[model samples]
Target: MRRLRCPYCGAVFEVPKGAVYAVCPYCGTTVVAKTGEEATRQYYYPPRLDDGEAFLLAVSRARMLPGAPADIAETASLARSELHYLPLYICSAEAWVEGCEGAREEREETWLATSRLPLPGLEHGYRFPVVGREPYDPRRARRGVFHQPDASPEPRCSALRARVEYRAAGEARLAGCRGSVESRAGLVGVAHYPVWLIEYHHPLAGQPLRAVVDAVDANLLYLEYPIPLERRALVLGGAALVLGTGLAAAAAVGLAAGSLAASILGGLVGSAVAASPLLATGLSRTGRYRYRPPRVERLFIKG
Candidate 1:
C-alpha cells in the first residue's frame, strides 16, 4: 500500500495510488484526490443518504415543487429507488482554441465572425460548481450507511480526458470558427456524484412518474409525470387551433396569389402538423401509466 499524508491531521497513512478519494483513518475527515504534482489537497462530499433512505427521501420531496400534483407525496406510490454514482473528472485547465475565421473580411477584404456556446444533458455532464482536491469539512460527517458505488466492470477513464477536450474544442467551433482547439489540464480529479432513480405512480391520474434525483443535495434534476387529462386536452385543442389558424392564413394567401397547388399543399402540411402533437399525446395517455422517460439526458445520471 502506498502511503499518503493527511493534510488535516498531518498523519501519514497507507492508501492505493489509484484511489481518488478516501476517508482519513486518523481524523475521520474525507480526503480528496491530489494530483501527483501538488502538495496541497482537496475534498469531495459523498452521498450522505443511504440505500434505505433513498426511497424515503425521494418520496418526501416528490410533491414539494410549487406546481406538483397535490397527492403526489401522499398518494403516489414509490415503486423503486436505485442508487447510482456517476463518474466525472472535474478539472481546471488552460485551453486555447485556434480556428481560422470561416470567412473573415479585413477592412478592405473578406468577412469575420465568432461566438460562444455549449454544455451537456441533465444526467450526464452535470456541471456543478463542484471542485476537487480540497480538504474535507469535518463537520460534514453525518450518520448514514453509504452503499458501495456501483462500478462498471469495463474500463471508463481511458477516453475521459479526450472526451472533455473534444467538448471544449467543439464549443469553440460552434462559436463560428472551424479550427483546432487544445486543452491542458492543470489539475484533474475524479468524483462520483450520487443519484437516485425513483419510479412513482401519480395519484391523480394514476399515471406513472419517473424521476431522477441528485442524492447529494436532493435536487430533482429531471421528472416525467402524467399531464392531467384536462391539461392534455388543452394541449391538443390549443395545438389544433394554432395549426388551423396558421393553415387558413397560408391557404388564403396562396389563393390570393392565384396558386391552387400552394394552397392545397399548405392545408395538407398543416393537417399533418396538427395531427402529430395529438397523436403523441394520445399515445402517452393510452396505458395506466403514461409513456415517459425517467430522465432528460438518459446518459447523464445513470452513467
Candidate 2:
C-alpha cells in the first residue's frame, strides 16, 4: 500500500495494494497510479534553503553570464513569491565503437590501396520511470525557502531517453570504422532536481523569455531566444531585397559576360542570401533576462 496525495484538493489517502488507480476523495479526480509497463516513482521535497543564502547563491550563478540584465536583483526578488521542489527523470548510457585498419602497398613504382572494413553494430537501451503529476503544481508550499520548480518528470525522462538513443545512433555513424561493442546503461529514480526558472521581461519583445538552469549540475536545459521585432524586420527584409537585386544583376552580368561565369556567381550569391536570415535569427537570441530561485523563508511570508 502507498499513501498518495491529491494534487487538486490536497487530500491524502492510502492506495491499496494491487490497485492501479484511485479516485480523489476531496476532488473526485481519477489518478492513475501505473501505466502499462512503467511504475510510478516517489519523490520527496528538499529542505528549503535560507532566504539570504538562496538569494546569494542565485545571484552568484546569475553573474556567470557575460551580459545578464541589470535588474536581475529585482527579478530574483519576485521569485520569493513561490517555491517548490520540481521532479525530473535522469539517465545515462555508454557508447562504444570499433573498426578495421586500411593500408597501402607500392610495387614496381605502382601505388595500390587495400581497404577491408567490417560493419560495426551498436547496442544500447534506455530505462525511464514515470513521475506522477502531484509534484508539478506551481502553487505548492515551499516550507519557507525559495524553491524553483524542476522539469516535469515524465517529459524530461522521455526527452532524455530520446536523446540517449539519438546520440548513440549519431556516434555510430561518426565512427567510420566499425566492430561490435557493448556499453552500460543506467536510470535514476524519481528525484527533485534543483533548477532556477528565470523569466525575462525585455523592453523589445512583448513576451518574456523563460530559461531553466540545473541546480546541481549547473546545466542549461531550456532557453528562450529574445527576438527584436523591429530589428529582425529591418535586417531580414532589407537583406532579402538587397540580395535579390544582387542576384538579378549577376544574372544580367553573366548573360553579357559569359553564361558560365554569371551562373557560378549567381549561384554563390543566391546560396548566401538564402542562408542569411537563419544566421541572423541565431544571433538575435543573445540578449536575454535571467531568473533564479528565491529564498525559502521569504516565500511563505505574507506581503
Give the candidate number with the greatest TM-score.
Answer: 1
Score candidate 1 by lDDT.
0.48
Q: Taking the tens digit of each residue's C-alpha lDDT, what string does model 2 give over 194-218?
A: 3345554545446654554433344
Per-model clash counts, in order, read 11, 10
lDDT of 1 by residue, 1-303 (tens): 467666667777665555555445544443553432222333445765664465555556544432344455566667766655443334443444565433221111100000111111252334443632234354653332222212221133324445555555555555666656554443344333456666766655554556666567655556555555665666567667767777777788888989967886877687768677564654454222222334655453211
- Indicate which candidate wins on lDDT: 1
lDDT of each: 0.48, 0.41
Candidate 1 segments exceeding 4 Å error: 1-80, 95-126, 131-183, 204-208, 215-219, 227-231, 263-278, 286-303
Root-mean-square deviation per candidate: 12.7, 17.8
Candidate 2 structure, TM-score to reference: 0.33
Worst 10 residues of 2 by lDDT: 105-114
Q: Model 2, residue 265: displacement in angstroms?
A: 9.1
